[model samples]
Target: MTYPPDPYQPPDPYRPSDPYRPLDPYQAVQPPPPDPTPSYPPPYTPTSPAPSSGSGYPPPPPYGGGPAYGPPPGYPPPAKSPFGPPGYGASYGPQNTSAMAIASLVCSIAGVVTCISAPVGVVLGHLAKRQIRETGEGGEGLATAGLWVGYILTVIGVVTALFYAAIFIWAIAEGTNVTTTF
Candidate 1:
């Protein structure tokens, strides 16, 4: 009886017994050895004389020194503005002014003009102040002025109302005759 075919047998006679053999026949051609000397041009050499040690400028630190300012060699210097200093345009933009601050000032001024509106002005001023504190808004001076004006007017209004009520109570208590005539 014939034995079972060997599973590990090579299919082709030309296949190598060694597993590491190159698959391509051209891979057997050896590459040329590396040249003893490099073919690139020589590095740049400065022609100018070195700065004198006695010069006022401090000597540059050795290579690998900490960070330095200005552009590195072979790079052009940064452009400068002719109008102003280095940071001329750094803060360019209109400053943001708070709307509540303006409203508070207007309300306070109106309260002073028309005493009846003192309470409204006081309320607006307080709200504006609170908002200003919560948000870093401008116009703090306006808000402060509004608060002062509104408070003063409110006090005056309260005092005047109390005085009128007291006078009416006193008049009635004095037993004055009351008559209605058309």
Candidate 2:
């Protein structure tokens, strides 16, 4: 007989005793130290803002509708022909050959572009080349280039004029007032 049986007792429910807890995994994962120098910009978002200049140039203009602008302020515009101007060549600095070439190639345009302001692209081109060769000036290419372009343009204009004439003859026989589109 083991004395009177003692009753088994459980731990106290209200009072908590310290219990060992493993370290938190997140605590070990610290965000990398704040970057001292970021390599990339944070972000960019376009909202709404008018351009600083060209305010007059609309979003888009109808083809060949508005007047073409000349060179910027104080800058002289390209002469009528690349080879026309005595002082207009690129070897010294920036040249305007491209403009001259384009202008020379179109007879209608050449008249307005050449410094002499007439059907003189061919003549000017030759003179320009001569000047370039003898005096070491620039624009030899421009003059030679203009001569070819002017010739081509003349041929094109003739063909175009002939086509229009044929159309005019047909219209006259048909007696129809056909309106030519501008």
Candidate 3:
């Protein structure tokens, strides 16, 4: 004996002739017939080389040997600069500081803190002043200040080191001359 169809059972796609088969909503709604005219762009055709202008100057060679006048087909336009078009005059004043002068000041300040870079500061200061004289950059006062600070610090460091060395030698000499008796 054949069993009756269950109400909750899903319809089978293979059994199309079944009396209880569910109708497909998509089958009734066929796709609209294709339009007679297509919306595609026109076919591309290569053009001949561009004629040079009558001004006597030769036309510039095409970039990458692709096109003679404009960019190759399907390419986007060139991007614009964020700073606007070229040929605009300075928007701000001359704020360019000398790199060597800045370095000299930094080294001098560091030497003041660590007590070792004083000589480097002096050398850089002299170089910075020479560069400023030639290039006419700013920061001349900073270079001079760095030079004075470095010189003073270097002399103090040397004198302090010598004074300590002399005291150490004196202590050693005194110790050797002393006699210890049991």
TM-score of each: 0.44, 0.31, 0.48
lDDT of 3: 0.75
Please report, in order, the local distance difference test score of every candidate based on alpha carbons: 0.67, 0.53, 0.75
Candidate 2 on 1-182: residue-level lDDT in tens?
12322222233433323435554545533334544654433232345344345464324423674347875434445558755657644455664344443444444346444424334665556556666666664465666667876565656666777999999999898876665788
Q: Quick one: ranking by lDDT, best first?
A: 3, 1, 2
Q: lDDT score, residue 144, model 1?
A: 79
Q: Model 1 segments beyond 4 Å from truth? A: 1-92, 177-182
> Which sequence of candidate numbers ranks them by TM-score, best first?
3, 1, 2
Instruction: Please list all clashing residue pairs in model 1, or write none if there are none.
Output: none
Please, what are the lDDT tens digits per residue for candidate 3 over residues 39-125? 434232236334467444445655574476764555555778897865665445685678888888888878867888887999999
- For model 3, the stretches where C-alpha displacement exceeds 4 angstroms are 1-92
Error of 1 at 59 (Å): 44
lDDT of 2: 0.53
